[model samples]
Target: MSQSVHMSVLLDEVLTALGDIKDKLVVDGTFGAGGYTRAFLEHGARVIGFDRDARVKPYVDAVSAEFPDSFQWINRPFSEMAEGLADVGVEAVDAVVLDIGVSSMQLDEAERGFSFMRDGPLDMRMSIDGRSAADIVNEDSAEDIAHVIWLYGEERKSRGIAAAIVRRRAEQKFERTLDLAEVVERALGGRRGAPVHPATRTFQGLRIAVNDELGELERALEVSEAVIKTGGVLAVVTFHSLEDRIVKNFFAERCGKLPSGSRYAPEVKAANDPTYELVTHKAQGPSDAELARNPRSRSAKLRAGRRTAAATWSEQTVSGKPSTNKVRS
Candidate 1:
């Protein structure tokens, strides 16, 4: 994973946070290009790595050749780990590390349609199946499209973009990534002096929607909570605010950091005792040195928690607040 990952952000911070897994088994939840798993293996921990992309098979095979008995690769979404790992005779893991959102490998491959930098089919599924971004653009209602762009991308001009997409698609359906990107840029008034390309947020939103990324992330965190043993570490590295916000709130809720709210809307407290202690009270960013080495990590944020001996929270107790939209830690 490190071979393709090139650099892992907050590498020192994550290793230090996990303490010494040593001989314990660790789950590399995302396995993107293998950065975390490589580090975990090097540190003497057995790794159970998960990923949906078949492109990682070569990297997984290479690691397997070297580590033999210590590494296992599961070609599935990280969200499936709870039941999947249990089925394989593993109930709990020493630590779980998730590097959320699209990987550098995916983004760089124009054929994957994760980026509009080079023209390619608008197919953004991490797996071979599922509805493609082109499908949504060509099939979804403008209002629905607007909702996805607004909610997932947090784009203020989503409605106009959706309208433009609709008008253009009526004449000729979007097929190429750059075609949609150009339409969005025009809809947003040709970028002006913006630092990033005009289509970045829309592409991000589409990718998230196409892959059900937020839902997958929510599930992965919940599953990790169930499978990490007492005193086990759960570290998450998120690239954007959407992922960071959920992680922060989950950590806050699990660590008893959130206060009981108003009488009308009281705080979501755990019926069981607090399940985790904050390994990171606030999100950690890439250090100056890391940023210098890999500028792509500039937006990365890492948050971690150490599980307690107490019981995990029930789903009903966590229903009081919207975990996805809660205040960040």
Candidate 2:
């Protein structure tokens, strides 16, 4: 039997925040399953969807056949959206939406190696052109693996997990999801009275490392700011704390609130002026109704901001420095 997959995240919230784009151009940065793209089209907007996965090719073909030129699909990473858009003569868009991180479609497919629940080959590359999770697990050093699992996955038991994986791989190479999961489970036992699986964090860590997910997401955020026109909306749906931190900090820095310390110190003035006007004061998540329908929506967080008319994308600085935040620790 095969696993059933559904996109259990902030679908409606993302669409609502995007609001009215009739006859205007919009960019779907993630373009997984065509959810946001479809909504934009329904609003009478023209869309250019971007995805690194060649697996998306067929879906793109199907949608293009139905909508014709109203929707253009670009088979490229969101980080490269800037370059790809230029080739197509697209200078600016009315809005940009990015649903970051792995998708249910990728995980449910056993061959893709995203889910630790199912036994499958450890290959979690979003694009077919890169090195896979299998490659990293079977080859990376313990220190590197621990760092990735710790920083990207935020797994507290990273050292134990990495040591276990290294020891096991020395006996035999890790080839499948269950093979690695079992090692991690053996290394880090379940929490007291907790129901979460032990392998979850390790799997997430491996996937993020294999795909360079955070690095690409940060670059995409920068590129989106560059191409979205003034008054344009930028909505991002993040599934993890690391991603939420990036989104939170991005909005704060752009709105000139980056230097503020909560209940600790006075606000330090930013060296430069603000660029984006925050649309939401705090991050919004799935509504109670949506959460009832899809449990996965529980972890989803959506942050949105509107580009100021006088703002140039380059004008926004994160931490009073350029927006380069990658923690390999």
Candidate 3:
């Protein structure tokens, strides 16, 4: 049998924030390969694991048989978790943990089309329901293609890469992962001396676009805050700066810092009482040892918040709602 894939970044810290899980119902929002689920079960936590990828259900099923009545796995996006669990009459949860982004299993499987190192179909949909990356690459207008690459991948040479893609597709459409990777490599003049692959950012961009990852993540955060009970722990392990920023801002706004120039003046009505108590004032990153074990973890950032005992629905509790300043449309 193949060795189990390791989860990237802050795996230990995430579980720690969850507290003793004995009999406490928790939601493993990402459910990618069940790494967090396994740990939660071992700690005697009752878990409802959710993943958009139906393939994970088999593994979850196996675990359920081993620990009957302790685990429930749902093959659907975490965004729908609230409703999925409601069928069984679960209204609120004790904790919700979301490890966002692609899993090691997705990248390792050559047929999954998530990695450039392994040749696969250009499909990058995590749910298998949305349009594939291949569709975007071969059919999107140059401007649209460039926008996805630049906005999601942060690739500086997005225009050049998009132009090359359009030129190549005119002859033959992109059918495989490496086919697009090669074009990105050539346009970027190759990574020659760099340890990272030249196409890393391009692939990241494509996957984000195909999955609409950021938008989903933002929604999940909001929904989680609403559904989790007061004193619940909300932990998120993000693999990129963009993901980290959203988590950071969400918690900061919930904590409700005073507006500038208000320390001496009568407090401006304290807009909203704090919901989550910031667990770590700043975000946490992987340790050096972890970095050595998994280079993919280098970019990972973990931010955690504990729902205050007085926590309330973010918008309902607060008089006004905070705006989600998304970088992309």
On lDDT, the leading prediction is 1
- The whole-model lDDT of each prediction reads 0.87, 0.81, 0.82
Cα lDDT tens digits, model 3, 1-329, are 12255463587878777777788889999887777887888898899889999877667767778778888888778878778778778878888999989988889878889999999999988887979999999999999999998999888999999999999999999999999999999998888898889898889999999998999898888778767777778999998777887888778777765444556774333466676788777888888988888888888888888876444545544636543222101
**RMSD to truth, every model:** 5.2, 5.3, 5.4
Model 3 poorest ten-residue lDDT run = 320-329
lDDT of 2 by residue, 13-62 (tens): 77677777899888998877776777688779999999998886766776
Give the C-alpha lDDT of model 3: 0.82
List where candidate 2 sits over 4 angstroms from the true fold: 1-5, 190-193, 313-329
lDDT of 1 by residue, 174-216 (tens): 9999999999999999978998999998999999999999999
- In model 1, state the lDDT of residue 163: 99
